[model samples]
Target chain A: MFRPCGLFDETYAKNIAIVRTRQHWILIIIGLFIFLTFPLYLSGRILHFINLLGITLIAVQGLNILTGFTGQISLGQSAFVCVGAYTSALLTVHLNFSFFLALPCAAIITAVIGTIFGAPAMRIKGFYLAMATLAAQFLIPWMVTNVRTDLTGGSQAMHVPAPSIGGFVFNDQQSIFYIIIPITCLSIFLIRNLTRSRVGLAFLAIRDNDLAAETMGINLTKYKLLAFFICSFYAGVAGSLWAHWMRAISPDQFNLMESVWYLGMIIVGGMGSVIGVVYGVLFIKVFDISIILIGPRLTSFLPPQLAQDTAAGLAPFTFGMIILVFLIFEPRGLAHRWEIIKGYFRLWPFKY
Target chain B: MLLFVQFLINGILVGGIYALIALSIVLIYKSTRVFNFAIGEMMAIGAFILYTFLATVKFSLWIALPMTVISTLIIGFFIERLALRPLIGQPILIAIMATIALSLIFKGIVFFAWGSPIICYPERILPGEATMVGKLFLSNELICTFLITISVFISMSLFFRFIKTGLFMRATAEGHDLAQASGINVERIFAVSWAIAAMIAAFGGIMLGIRFGIGIGTLPLVAIKAFPAVLFGGLESVLGAVIGGLIVGILESFVGGYIDPKFSEITPYIILLLILLFRPEGLFGLKRIERI
Candidate 1:
């Protein structure tokens, strides 16, 4: 059991030499990041960005489960998140329910919808699965706007009031920040521990090879649906928080673009790593927010008309370009890059 | 009955436009097995080019149309080389995301280059509606639509049938490895496929602009509509593309004419979802499981 403690066989010995770092170093890096981020939260310019980062981190966690764990590709994760957002918003605002009451129900409702939509999973995988999700992307938004127009507020956007607890209102952006950050941290910890457990192992097993896993007596349907449920449940939680944080719910927020951003977070963050989700969200979302702020500054040298034209367009273009550049050259992402820097220190003076 | 015929005429005209649009998607997938999600945006870019060239540069249609086609072809070829070629042996999902990213980038770039406002394509053809076969009403726009559709169809059919360049493209599309083994330049052929797809998209966009005038704000939705057309016809077959386009166009027309005004607009996509549930392969599409 302690063989990976630099006392292992040939393969692990070589790997550990490369990857294993003193635990204190990672702690320091994380600690430093938190310290830097703490000051940003104090500033007004970044409160909204930080809150968005928190919600995105949660959404990426859900995606990490589907893509990073179960090997499913979904472009409709935003739709599931929308499901949770609308459900929770509806419950809290119209039904006069509390966040605590609405949150679980929201997650449950999203899970149920995810599993049902995921029923097509038995027959489809890869690009076919992608197409199916694309269908869901079109379907849910259409349903919310067209069929359940009144309830979903159609395209007019719905107001989700600030969450209240007992007698206290978690009203402002700062208060919502407190709620989101802790939930994000808790989810990260829970997913990390959960993946180490039997359920997580099963998901990984299924991801690696469904046939092999099934022959080992893992029920493919049960486990696959469970993954859909769990993954989507996480999306629900993220959505509920976002609905409250933004104090609004519009189909625009859950458009296909957001889904692609979430996928970018997973791929560019480092697939199959919990730290990847957080890093991906923070790195991408922060860069995105920074671009919105700094894009015009860079383009200020350009003609005034040109600068105005480039402002709205440059952010999405830069994001897509970054994703392309990173995917082509740095598929392992920032988490893996950070791992490498730590490795150089851990292996100092050992020339191996 | 006159209303039905009028809607049918409009449907077929628009359907022909959609057929050209879906052909871009089908052609790319045929050779490379990569679904080019950026086709609609490519169409939008073409429309933007033509829109700007005529309105801003005051270029002739003959010059502007070819210019748009050539530029878009270059863009598509570069995208394949820059975004997709590196991901050659990577999973299909990477390619899908790459193309999706390309689509987003295209949307962003176009949204930037051409402001997001809706720019109508100025009417160039003479204004005259004609009564054909006693009850059938035809216009210069409809005639142009028919002519463009037929010419595109004939040229493509001949290109694949008789042209050596077309043969190489078809071979590359059919299977890259086999084409490579047969001494064909497979990578070059893939680039050619993208160029050809872009050309078709450009043609479609120009035609649509000429027919309905380009609506800049709603260009993204054009590709979104084309998806269901591809869904109806099966993603891989050329004939299926035409058939699917016509069916969706006609069905949508009938629904818009007879059904509730709101629901009519959604009829095509709703039908597409229903068709997908029962026949995932689509009409005239070969049944394919996930893996070979």
Candidate 2:
């Protein structure tokens, strides 16, 4: 807000006018060169990281639509993802379908399930609905494992054959990255369009005041269900992509903990924005990998028992701490920070 | 017939304790107007505190229980002060997330301290095998749980009805701005509310550890279990918690015992889905509050 409003830039002009430092063309060229090389660097060892990032970004975006845009709290995103993954995977594996066919199938199935799940939204809000969603998170997996053991593999993972686009199998990490990047770009575009449409305005209105929205003839039930359906559809697609990427689907792949991770992503990245979703997922996951990378080296400084004992526990502590600090200090999230920086650059010459 | 009766007895027994867990949540939400997502972890810490005081140092149940309650109260106070107080005027999302973060923190700290080992609390205080039956059977755990819960409820009622501080707390909860305007110390009430909520959570945790034989997994499980109870009862209603707990407990046991053995968690969730679909207000919830 301050960035676009030009408070900091104006303040800087008034206070710090004596000295100036500038970057040369070589520096800018070097920055652009590094920026362009990031993909080349990533294309070698861990192009699959992009696929995982894509899937997580989709999940986070779905959550942002529900929680940030519509003000509908959901803790059962895992359950919806499970629905999509299972549906899509089953289509490809059991029904002998193509990847494109299976993807839409997954989205439809998850969207239907999501609407049914969103029925809880009619009754509960804030925390109660959140807990209800939490129940869905655990229940869906348990049901997939135990109740539908004949279809789902229970504890064992169900195999998904590698997806092929036009007979060329995306059987490897590098090949999978192509699907992930394009789908992510498409998802971001679709969400952007949707948020600008009549549907999005209705969503915002219902989020602000459902009673007022309904009084204005907005049809709260319809829009609320639509939000759930759309949100779940994206999760389903993400899950399907994940199933294809991992070449398998299992109940453990989607859990209550991941649901919280998704929520945290939207919160950290910036709620209700595409960029926020990207930033949140990359930030948290990068921090996660950092712990894994640094854990062994840092813990060696302590006693062996303490070092050995903390291997599994440190990531959660770090994550929890991040959430607390962010909530306390920067509840609007990192996207707001991006806005501030962008605003600084865009309005440098003007006095407005 | 015997198995059915046995499941019924077990369900009722567990339901009593579940009701107790939901009460702690209800008490806090009633006063603070914040849903403590960390309730399960709070309960876990309570049980861990009791375990550490007893197992780590070799204390009796008589001494350990009070110490557990007090220590958990301190934890609760620290959390409210450190995390929640700063988020008071912010969006509800921040407060909820703060508890979740606190949940992760407390779980990590406990796991770090006690090493994630399952410690079965000795059934020292709660009696075993106190039963009387002719055509049917009874269990001591069921009887004992109900007795403690009822006593606690009665005590709380008395406190709210008679005690000056309790009344003050109620006034503050009803509307903090109004209460502040009326010369009540709303900040003190907030701290006290968190303390009371923590104490109740600790009580529920000890009882649950006793019931489940103690494990690190019990905290998250029990925390999740408390939801159906709270939802079944209105989130804001005490009596609703007990009724909801019993209903959810019986339904869950009935499903697990008879309907389908493999997928036990599905039944309560299905019930929740239906209740949400048809009667979103819950049995005791206020209907006017449903915005859509």
Candidate 1 CAPRI classification by DockQ: medium
Runs in model 1 with CA error above 4 Å? A1-41, A205-218, A301-304, B122-143, B211-216, B289-292
- What is candidate 2's lDDT per residue for A1-352, written digit by digit as tens? 2323433434756444322224545675687576444555566546666668788888778877888788888888988888888888889978899988999889888989888878767656666677668768877888788765777787799999888877699898766776777788688778877887799888888777778888999987778888998899899998889888888788988988889888888888877776778889999988988888897787888788777657657877889998888888888789988887787678777644
Model 2, which residues run further than 4 Å from truth? A1-45, A302-305, A344-352, B1-4, B122-142, B289-292
Pairs in steric clash, model 1: B31-B173
Query: Residue-wise lDDT of candidate 1 within A97-204, one digit each (tens)?
Result: 988889889989998998777766776566666767777777787777877677778998898888888788988766677788888878887888778778888988
* Each candidate's interface RMSD: 2.3, 2.6
Candidate 2 CAPRI-style tier: medium
Q: Which model scores highest in DockQ?
A: 2
User: What lDDT is reached at residue B236 by model 2?
Assistant: 74
**Per-prediction TM-score, please?**
0.90, 0.90
Tens-place lDDT digits, model 2, residues B1-292: 8878877877777788778788887877777788877888788778778887888788988898788878878877777788888888776677778888888887777667766667776547675676867556676766777777777778878888899888997787677789999999877777877888888888777777776755556666766776777877887777888888878788778888887765466666777766776776678976554545
